[model samples]
Target: MGDTGLKRHGRDRRPGGNDVARLAGVSQKTVSRVFNNEPNVTTDTRERVLAAAQQLGYRPNGAARALLTGRTYRLGVVALGTSHFGPSSLLVALERAARSINYALSIANSFEDDPSGLAEAVDNLLAQGVDAIILSEPVDDGEEPLVVDVPVLTLGAAPVVHAPTVLSVRAAEGGDAAAAATRHLLDLGHRTVHHIAGPQRWWAARERLENWRHTLVAAGADVPEAAEGDWTAARGYEIGKVLARDPGVTAIFAANDEMAIGAIHALHEAGRPVPGEVSVVGFDDIPVAAHVWPPLTTVSSDNAELASVGLNYLVDYLNQPDSPPAPPPKHVHNLVIRDSTAHPPATEKGDTRA
Candidate 1:
């Protein structure tokens, strides 16, 4: 029992397949076959090899296997890194979908709206050798499309990457949703629907704004200048204050639920009752949308489904590179009518209800 050579070497050496084979009394090839799930090995032999691997704390080398197979089985995700509801929710769904397909996900955040930042992020992911890449929140930097060698999947309608393997899965058209919200307000006899728009750099925000304008024009409604917000309640509230003071502003549409909530707070502070005096609508029916005072009438997009469908398409491309590219599925949104919207105040019609 004096310092055995076996114990001394075991403490210092990293366990390998050879070590497991030695412990299991089998050839190294047999151990490798067992790990690789190749047929012809007896059940008992496989069990012994696995038990020996566990006892010795031996793990298969993924890098070695990847090199042999020429696939990393990893998906890289490029996101805006914002806490905004859409991007965050889509990321969660992407992770879950990747896991379900036995692939690993690596996420890199681009905090800036610069093309250089996006290029750097994509390069970083490529350096890590991901089999495929996903652009979760693609923004137009007013530059040429990004060039990538590997298969690329985008979660939105805009094509951010230009590659032979590029595929796009579209989310519900933001412009359509925005137009619906605006039309809802106008139909209620409001003169105009003011807008609290998200940052301009975001393609989603721009689409929402454009659609709002287009809808107003089509209906011959006044299109007031939109107030900009950074997708925050604070910014929404700041915009809200100005809107509340305007007696002609009887309806408002925010780009997201957080901004909508902030607008409601501003209206309350200004003694303007929601639905009674000013109706508010928002995009992205967030979880608290139904619980807020007066509740929120908003457009609900299936963000999780968008991620799942996009990831599945990427996986299909990975498995079948030669298959003719099929058309990407369209994501749809529904408008949820809640307590936050109503007809314009009756005071203008000389109908008073105390």
Candidate 2:
């Protein structure tokens, strides 16, 4: 029996070669070849080494192996701590993908206000020996950290750039979906669609606002003052009340589903008929979107796929550090047209037909 003190936290930290040699009655060097996947190890030797590893819990340290080979099989992710829809979803997806590829992920939460914080976080990840880093948030105007010792990749929340970055479903695409929602309202002949946008600091908010403006401009409709909501139903309700009182504001495009739900409640309390007096369209087809009284007509963002793509990209970089950065993946968004949107009221009276 090996000494318990040899392991830390009760984990078997016994050297694989020593355990393999003991079980096979061979030299430790022969065992090393088998464990390293090196050539020249006989099948019988390999089986003995494998058996010894299983008995001793002598798993190879991937990080140590990389250090020996000058490659680390670890990736770092920079995500925001805020509970916004896109960032949070991306983080969860990344965790799943990283595990699937036999790579570990080191995540760092960043703040939007201080863009420099990203570089600082990158430094921290580097210190932790991460092989590559993915920026899930936007890059601020600072000295670009593109050519770090390790490769860097980017997802949404950052502007599109032709570089080593890989983008997976960006806010701009989300904006396009928002535009589709606005156009759905326009097709119904609503004069204009009012918008309750999220906080400006988020890339999703900026992109959605831009799409809303672009859609209105194309239609030659007056874009009403957009109230800012913080991805919360409460803020949505507060902003919805203001839009509800306006006779011209017949339709609304909320940046997220939470806000959309709040907007629905606000409109209901103000006695405005949905799809009759005022139509509402929202982004992000969250679970609750389908449950609302008149289900929300919203765009579905595939965060799971997005996260998986990013994680795969980083893992590949770890395998082939010299592999020229992969091009950003094209993200597809589909609009789910539910009952939340319809013809805006011709006159600000009441028409409650489903």
User: Which candidate leads the pack in TM-score?
Assistant: 1
In terms of lDDT, which candidate is strongest?
Answer: 1
Query: RMSD in Å for candidate 1, one decimal?
Result: 7.0
Write down the worst ten-residue block by lDDT for model 2.
Answer: 160-169
What 10-residue stretch in candidate 1 is worst by lDDT?
1-10
The Cα RMSD in angstroms, rounded to one decimal, for candidate 2 relative to the true structure is 6.8
Give lDDT tens digits, candidate 2, residues 1-354: 343244558785656556557766788787656654455678887887677766666766786668776656678887776777766877888888776555678987777667566667767788888877777855353545344465667675564333343435454444467778888888887878889998886666887898889999999999888888888999999998887787667788899889988999988899987876788888878877899889888889887877776666555554554667566565666789888788655554564423
What overall lDDT goes with each candidate model?
0.83, 0.73
If scored against the real structure, what TM-score would every candidate get?
0.78, 0.74
For model 1, residues 2-85, the per-residue Cα lDDT tens digits are 221245444766678888888888999998777655557899999898888878878777787688758787889988878888
Q: In lDDT terms, how accurate is model 1? A: 0.83
lDDT of 2 at 6: 44
- Give me the displacement of residue 222 in model 2, in angstroms: 2.6
